[model samples]
Target chain A: MNIALFGKLIQLLIKEKMAYRGDFLLSAFAQIVSYGGEYIVIWLFMKRFPLLAGWTWPEIALLYSFGLLTYAIGASFSFVQMRELEGQVRQGTFDNLLIKPINPYFYLISRGFNLAYVAHITISGAVLIWAIGQLNVQWTLLNWAYVLLAVVSGAMIQAGLLTAIGAATFLWVRAGFLFTIFFRLKEFISYPLPLFGTFIQLLLTIGVPLAFVNFYPAAFLLAHDSAPLPGWAMWLAPLVGPLVYGLGYLLWTSGANKYQGAGG
Target chain B: MDSFELHRYVYKLPVNAFREQLRFCMDLLSVGEFAHKPVRQLSLGQRMRVEIAMALLHEPRILFLDEPTIGLDVMAKDQIRQFLRAVNRKKPTASPGRNLPGRSLPRASLPGALPDERRYGVTTYMMFAVKSFTNQLAYRSEVWLRLLGNLLAILIQVEIWRAVIGSSGQEGASLDQMITYSILNPLLLALLSTNVSEAVDSSLKSGSIATELIRPLSYPLYLLAGSLGLSLYKLAFTVAPAFALAGLLFGVLPPASPMNLLAFVAALLIAMLMSFLLGYLVSLLAFWLMSHFALSWMLGGLITIFSGSFLPLWFYSSGWAAVAEALPFQYLGYVPAAVYLGTMTDEAMWRTLAIGLIWAAALLLLVRWLWSRAVRRLIIQGG
Candidate 1:
């Protein structure tokens, strides 16, 4: 909503983050090692076994990267705002937003443009790039543009889900469980969609559409598009991101209205 | 997204401080540069400044703080000292040039009494444990969701293990054993990973570490007892229910035999103590290091791999398994689970248990030494 302000906030966070030069370096190393360990678990297991649902190691890595890339970008901004909503609602402090002259959404998102995710983005981005190379993905201009759009849309899907969850806090203060459930589901999407049973596949595709965040886009990219959803749906990143985020915004508006009407 | 909880706390005040007022406080404290930074990004001095601003934002007549400058450098402590003095002496600023005096006591929350030197008995620590157990009971409404989350975690692991093992059955560990392994990791985690590091870290920050250390009760024992309370609570509520659900939905294999079950129980208790000891060992480093992030983080990685929580030792190459056996981490995660599966040979079980006892004793001695030294430093330097 406010491009300059968002950029400015990001700038300030980076500078502040770098102020702890030694600590940051140590923690970044630890962060990489920690996340790398998670991947190592998968790698170690897969090394001994056959392909999971016919999905190779590199292919699985790509899918996992898509999930991380989307989350890193989306959560780099919206993570704090979304989690903060439940507390604000329960404490009756969200009214500060309604009373403010500035758009609360912009204020909330921009203020938390966390630079902590620099590690996540770099780690995931490297993995995604390496996976793409390993898979020999044809990098046509249109394909490149499509990849970019999918990444962006995947991020929106994450942020939109979080936003809707946050907005629902306006209706019920104890909407925190949704956040936990949403995160657990995010873990599920790191695998190929069809690796799961029909129920889970359906849940990912329709119940929540978490598939669009990684599974489907990844399938489309690798040309192994045997997902539960149709072929064209794999390319729906641009539409889904905004569509979900728009719905979240609508929920926010209505929730805000009810909160104000109740004099809360 | 990392701004301090200052905004939320500020807004939660009975009287909302206008955004303009917040800006004024930020400027006054020279915390202007920190307005958008996450709390984690801030230096000790910077965070202290933000804390001061948070307190001042509500325009409270009296301010109470606990060890605001406890970990600050000389210059930063003096700056905070000067700021508090100035604020205390200044006229009420909510209205300009007011005759009313502002009541501010920055070190007000510091406990006054520190006389008890009597050592606490086991019963006293048990009371502490019971308190810890009841502390978690306040969130009854959230219990079901947490249970569901636990169940979901179990389901994810079960499916992955099934898919991996179903097609290509491994050596001694069959599909049933593998399923049991997947389900047990979460159950053990819920029962044993008591977040001892966080508990100890917070107490250190709150200045309660001084009191706990000075008391005759062994602080580590107290922590162990407290965490034991937490584990029991988890078993009764979260772990037991989730285990039942998982057992019903996706069958978890029973122990290899009656003897294996007995050994498994013994190993589980040992595993609990091992994890708690390791957590305490790392967390106590905060005294010398002031932050335990890197060490605990390193240990977490080691545990994930070496402990067989990520992959059972059976799945690993024999060389890798041998290397894992060389470390104490296997006791924390692998030994108990393996014993339950009856995969561990009788001789191996007895041998591992013996070594595990030695490791536990060694860690207890190490924790006691470090904690005593930490207490000495705290008292001498007034941490």
Candidate 2:
């Protein structure tokens, strides 16, 4: 409703943060180093072993890269879910947006920006580039396009998970720690989801659909040598992110209706 | 937009302090050393003002000020209070700019105002008595209660461990042997982790250190005393009940000997001291850093993982084990547990003790230097 107010908010953020150039760079650098180090550790392990539960190096790379991209986008844009909803609720600041003209969810999701998270993109990109060099896959134009689409959709799916958790806060006030459990579960996405046995794979495919963000795409890109999944599943992988996000949005709206306004 | 309303939402309050938030508020209103100085260099009072200012940076709709005036002169307190009042009144008059989640006003009753009437049933009185026993016993009591508490918590834990070991079909490992090893192992591990700065540092920020600092008592002794108090309370209310419930619900084993008990207590005391000092140094870092939360959190994670509280560091690759051994992280929780479990050697115990001392001295010096620097900065800045 007030685009000017939104611009003013952005301006305030930029203006306030501009003075802390050293801090900003230091924070972002630290995040990149720590997360990059973690990724390298995992990657190095995979390289030594060559394959994990039958998934090859490049395929693993795709999964890892896509997961990082989705996570990075989510971290860069809407990572406040990392703190969970309890803080805002406990602080009694959850209603600050309720008095505003715009949707409270938008403001809540974007409120605390962690620019450091974008550093993950750099780390993931390096991993992808290195993996691509090692692999012998012919990159088609459509494959590249699908890759871009997959990244975008993966971001949506990741955001959708967080958004759903954010929405669920209206019902379960203590759902803040539950978000931590979700993030911890994301560690499973770093590998081929199917390797974990049927029950977990089923849960990831349908329940969380996190597998679509990484494993499926990686399987298709690397071909059948490493990945057991069919090529058609690769196309389906890209769709799952958006479909999950749409479903999450539907749930979000339903939950939003329960919000009792700032004064309530 | 009321400061009081904001405070209600953000802080839990029995409002205990060496000097409470009100003192800081009162100081800001007065004309004195604090009034003339910039907040950063004005002693603890001025430091508090700077802290409040920092907290207000994001223009928090609801802000919690914990013990805002712990060591401030009266004049400084008045100014802070006046500043808070002005901020509260003027905040909503201007542009509310960003649309955060909540209104400035709190929606529910303040935590302290609600009466806690739910009783823990028949054991409630016993628990209450256990908690208050130290307070009732008055003279030179810090050491007595502190040692007693540490002794008791370790004993209980060892007893539980012994019971577990006995049932697990490990022969020649008497309840006493198991208790001794369990206590020593955990103590060593706890000591090791105390060597790291993170856990020790954050605990200090809880404002638990101020009472110890202002008192004539040495920092370690005071910490030991407080920890002892906590341990005693934990033993009665936490360990006893936990064991009781565990035993009643499912069968349990008890530890074998009093010597194992003594060794465990000794190691645990050292570990507790190490933990407190570690946190003390970390909190001291706040004087230098904007907020030590992220750094502390990261450090805590590394320590926890390396220390092998989740799983034994021995189970990690030999390389990781070397890394863990090289640092004090393993001493935090794992060593003491391991010692009590009879896993660590006498040589390792001595090494842990020596490392604990080195860490303590290093941290003590660091804290003193940091404190001096912070005080100087506060004096120069006058905030």
Candidate 3:
């Protein structure tokens, strides 16, 4: 990707979004309220139980906020593209992307950067800060580095999943139902994995591997002394995101090759 | 009982009256053979005829037929058209309206011959509602998607509640009650909520609002009627079946008592109307704002939080509860569920119902006032 061109595209989109500032602000507030409502539900539950499966309120908040942060970042870049892939294919617009000099995947991902997800970042960032303040963890340079690495890996995992789902549109023509199911499943990783039964736990861990996106990494950083996962598994969680993302990218390429256009 | 017998029982009609109406319907629609069969076993056209007959059993003043010929063979269409014409000729007072946009007039000449005095009334709104109900039948693919989504949502909630309640063994609310509340919240929201705001916003964007403005009826009311029709359809076809299935699978709690069930139904109706008014109010804001998407989202967020859809009001702090009570959002979801669960006392239920009615009346006025202003703005802007 041309860094300058990507920056210009983002700038232009921002400008366009700003033209309807009132609508943008209202939508952003709505997004904030949506996430805020989820946090409040968690808070209310924490108040009732004091601890969820062995995790405290602030710890759960940290896990959820990290998930939200990475989801927002990934979605800001890829959501529209992923959602519109079917429409573009039906309209023969995907052919234009393939004809471009740039890598089509990167180009598709770079275009249509949604600034509305700033609301997600703001709300989740606040929760993360509050949770950290509540925790007695001794933060060092290594811990901070690990947190940074985990956040990026989480974003990659989200982007990968979305890309793969978008690629499925080539065969299905409309992958919206699949997207909805996956999105609902993604909501599971925001809390402590132990609260779920073994079946769901295994499903999230290995079936879709959403646990590697937020839950396991956060557990390692905050509660390593009593992390639920095996010791090696906790350490290996960060690598799972990139590995899943790489597999998803390969799936997308293969699906792209198989695309014979809507006429076919 | 078959559909015919069930309709008679539900309507509390005398045996002779019910038989006469059923015979008239069957003879008119040529569905006498299918009348004895279960509704589920009927083919689409056969079911449509039965539904039309059932809808006419009450002798409604205005009859609305929405795509009455949809999915029918050519012969079936001709039969339905002939039956409708015969019905129209028999009841001169009841104007039978068919929503056929582009097609030439049928031999019946219903819409064109309707007098000006009969053009606007309760019957017209009822027709709009019926039209909306039938329109939703076309989207068969959405039913599975909606069922899956609702099922997933219920499962997630059940799991979360089980985990939370498991820790303390109990909370502010009992586990069973909480589960019931969670189940009803989404079901009611799905049944009551409307995309009217988005619909109005899109019409405004596409410059179709101009066509609506030229119509004799009030645009907002038209939208409301249409939404009511859509809601009724979903309640019957989607929400009811989904709720039944979910309840069977998850074991939902029944209403606390017969009285509570009555109060819950009343509260639910008021809540749905209030939701429609709120949606209309939000959409009218599109007149001033360039886009309504953000505003609609913001309204959704407010509803999600204040309406207690995500969490029951009892779970909130007293201070937060007071704020929520002061607002109209609680009437949308909380009051009805609370009443059904018998969480609120009889006095509180009455008070909440009273408050809900007041809000509905107030919002209705606001919607009317804002709609006039929106129309004026549209006129000024040449929208």
Q: Using TM-score, give the best candidate's number.
A: 1
- Cα deviation of B225 in candidate 3 (Å)? 2.4
The candidates, ranked best first by lDDT, are: 3, 1, 2
Clashing pairs in 3: none
* Ranking according to DockQ, highest score first: 3, 1, 2
Superposing all C-alpha atoms, what RMSD in Å does each candidate have to the true structure? 12.0, 14.8, 8.9
> Model 3 over residues B226-288: C-alpha lDDT tens digits?
899999988887888888988987778999999999999999889889989888888888778
In order, the B-chain TM-scores come to 0.69, 0.45, 0.69
Better of 1 and 3 by lDDT: 3
What's model 1's lDDT at B298?
76
In model 1, the runs with Cα more than 4 Å from the true position are A91-98, A260-264, B1-117, B167-172, B208-216, B293-295, B380-383
Model 1 chain A: lowest-lDDT 10 consecutive positions: A255-264
List chain A TM-scores, every candidate, in order.
0.92, 0.87, 0.94
Q: Which portions of model 2 miss their true places by more than 4 Å?
A: A1-11, A40-51, A55-62, A81-96, A224-231, A261-264, B1-279, B297-325, B330-365, B368-383
- Screening candidate 1 with a backbone cut-off below 3 angstroms (N, C-alpha, C), the clashing residue pairs are A112-B1, B2-B38, B119-B216
Q: What are the per-model DockQ values?
A: 0.34, 0.05, 0.40
**Which 10-residue window in model 3 chain A sums to the lowest lDDT?**
A223-232
True contacts kept of 2: 0.00
Ranking by TM-score: 1, 3, 2
Q: Which candidate is the best by lDDT?
A: 3
